[model samples]
Target chain A: MGTELVGGRTVLGTLRSDPPLTLRQTGHGTVHLVSTAAGPLGGDRLELAVDVAPHTTLEIASVASTLVLPGNGESLTVVEARVGAGATLRYAPEPTVLAAGCAHRMVVRLVLEEGASVSWREEIVFGRYGERPGTCHSRFDATIGGVPLLRQEFVVGDPAVDGSPAVYGDARCVGSVLLAGPAFGHPGPGNGGRPGNPRGHASVIAEGCAVLPLAGPGTLVSALAPDAATLRARLTWGLGRS
Target chain B: MDAALLLLADSRLPAGGHGHSGGAEEAVRTGAITGPEDLARFLRGRLTTAGLVAAALAAAACELATAPGAAADQAGTRPDEPAAGAAPESAWRELDAEADARTASPAQRNAARTQGRLLLRSARRIWPSPALDTLAGAVPDGAHHPIALGAVSAAAGCSPHDAALAAAYTSITGPATAAVRLLGLDPVVVHRVLAGLVPDLTSVARTAGARAAWERLPAHAAPALDLLAEQHLRTEVRLFVS
Candidate 1:
């Protein structure tokens, strides 16, 4: 379905973190987020909209795994984000877990002027499905400075499709993120195949990392830190300082 | 089999496709794909899903380009009775928009569009179809592969039938050559393998049904390849994305 914010001011920047949330925003505010609590949610939506005037910092967060339920009624919880120019939007949400048979659709849109910076990440687990063993379709679009910088679409699942060698060769876990603005000036990895380069992908940042392969896993976590240098360097390399 | 199709579809055409492995080299590194058969399977899957999808979209564009007097025919149209001419120019507006929506990764999309532009740069000269000229004029940046290929086919005096043939051959030839590079297969052996595919590709090209004519053209699908790409994005150094 659609997300309805529970509480907030006039600006459409309000946040409610319950099973179903609503966030409204009126005038100047850093952010208005509706975060979900612990435990599994029955496929609820945390809808958020940020109005970052001239110069503003709005950081949004999710309480936990926003447990996305297997889809029977086409279960979904979506976030509709819109960003204005000269605004810094740092949206780092907890990874969404698609419990067995669950399906989800997420749409994020950011409209930035010449100098707005946005670091957004989308990660998913196939759930009890053992490395996400089914079909999933996702579409993402972004327009920065009148240029449509990113647009992604994919469908996972089905024999006719799965049987093909083209789409998915074998990896299970997947993640995608986009970086915009001046700080990303020297796009590091340029094309993402160079040696020792890692810029565009924010997930590699040391703030939270588990370098160990996932064949067998162990818990690894760390609070976010202001020391974004290593991250920045990696980003530069990943983006290929071009 | 026509030798021209082999040249037309070769990824090493300096079309910037060398920058992309269609996720082959990338996926293989991630262990998402392995060995010769795996490569074949992956390539086949891409052709049917992502490849097929791209072809369908391109076919529509060709149909549009072929419209009679398509000043009238611009680009991105269906190969309807271009005898009418007006249909293609208008249809392309929507078709190209749809392609923009379907393609996500900005980098990958850029790769595709860039390839299309270069292909058009060369194809327009090699085959100069009015459809190609008009569509290229209407879309200065060059349309996506399907659109460009469609226009190219139209200009070359081939029907939608020819478009399909060209697409299939282009898709297969690239991988076959790559296989030759990766496995060091003899050119004679590669040619034999390629020869075996001709009948099937030609059949598909010539086989047209009413349903095929009216459908929304299939879309590109290659998640394993994409995820492998994501995996590659994380690599410290790599030979290909997958």
Candidate 2:
């Protein structure tokens, strides 16, 4: 994380990781998050922090899909990020696959200063190869000047999700994209001008909302699909404009 | 079991709740809920996810309203400027924003606001309170339904748990009633389904009441419901507002 910036680059930044949790700087303002272990096993805990200073940008990605295996315990991931004024942070991680009998909890908190911009996506697959989905509890809380831009928590694999038409329905894949600040005037594909009529059934959640403008500050775009490929395509479409 | 809770939860309380089906109308139209069994599952799903979220929010609001100095917090209040001369409860706005963030569908958000407005109108007459006036001033377009319900519950002397129960009970009862109207399902059978869910409903209320922190309140998102609301909004022959 950067405490200051110089010459349009991060002046102070640091990265720390434990086993199976490594950070690799792939390019200028870009980092590839890699895990050495086969994947997240039971009882694993991971923490990450990134700080983008003014006039700098940071992009985060994962090397491959993170596999969540069955375990007697649960795993947790907590990420804290700060996007400074005039800075940008884009986080697009690979999909996470929840295998049967696994329980995982993820919490992400982002603080954005004035003029900061962020474009992030999170994709989840219930299970791979037709297996039943495991349990997952994810919470995202973000703010600007202490005013809430987004506060959301989702639980999967509960009895409520088994056959709820109000939830997943028949889709096994779900994802969300968040675009905030003045930088995203309408980033991706689609006619960002016409109030966005999101359609197309086969791939996206037939009933999922495409793009939604928030009350005070941000925009949230969410989608549901039958598989990762469809979700990825839709996310890419959203990312293009953002 | 409080009388105030019952009154506030009553569908006939002139809240304009009858106009929206809570997504049941669209679900029925799409054949997602073709019979009583399907309707039962739908209600169960909604009760646990969205229902739980609403319950927690109502409970949180009730706590805020019943706190010490809540009344004097309301000073010079007029019809158009309600929040004026009032205690600065930034938490109220944050909770409202949380509701906005949890609601992913534009149609759903509009529906919730409409119902909230109607509830506020009815509450202001039924139970006169400066807190309600302050809320009205704060959110002229209308606060979200759960927020209004919580505030009204407090004005009516209901506990946070009572507010949670009221919120959770209405979350499903409204839709169950909608299903009966839309599909001509036997009211006897629908009531039976609701009866079977009594235990779960009570559990949900208790769980929601136990959570004191607004940020810790549930933020479950139902993609299917979000999609259905969006689809319902676009449908020309829709009978429900959402």
| C-alpha lDDT (0 to 100) for residue A81 of candidate 1 | 59
Docking level of model 2: acceptable
Candidate 2 regions with alpha-carbon error over 4 angstroms: A1-4, A183-209, A238-242, B68-91
Error (Å) of candidate 2 at residue B197 is 1.6
lDDT of 1 by residue, B1-242 (tens): 33554555656555555545555555555454555555556655666655655666655665666544442233323445435534444455455554653453333445466767877888877886666666666556556676677677666666655576676667666656655565566777667656755655655454420123222344443444444434456668755433
Candidate 1 iRMSD in angstroms = 10.4
Q: What is the Å distance of residue A169 in model 2 from its true position?
A: 0.7
Indicate the fraction of true inter-chain contacts that candidate 1 also forms: 0.40
Candidate 2, residues B1-242, lDDT tens digits: the string is 57877778888888898888888999999889989888888888888888999998888778767762332232211234343343334445556766876775667777888888899898899899887888777777678899889989989999989999999999999899999989998999999999999998999999988845565578877767877877787679977787
**Candidate 1 residue-wise lDDT, A17-92, digit = tens:** 4444524332343343343343233344444454554345566555444556553444444455555556666666
Prediction 1 TM-score vs. true:
0.60
For each candidate in turn, the TM-score is 0.60, 0.89
Cα interface RMSD of each candidate:
10.4, 5.5
- DockQ for every model comes to 0.26, 0.41
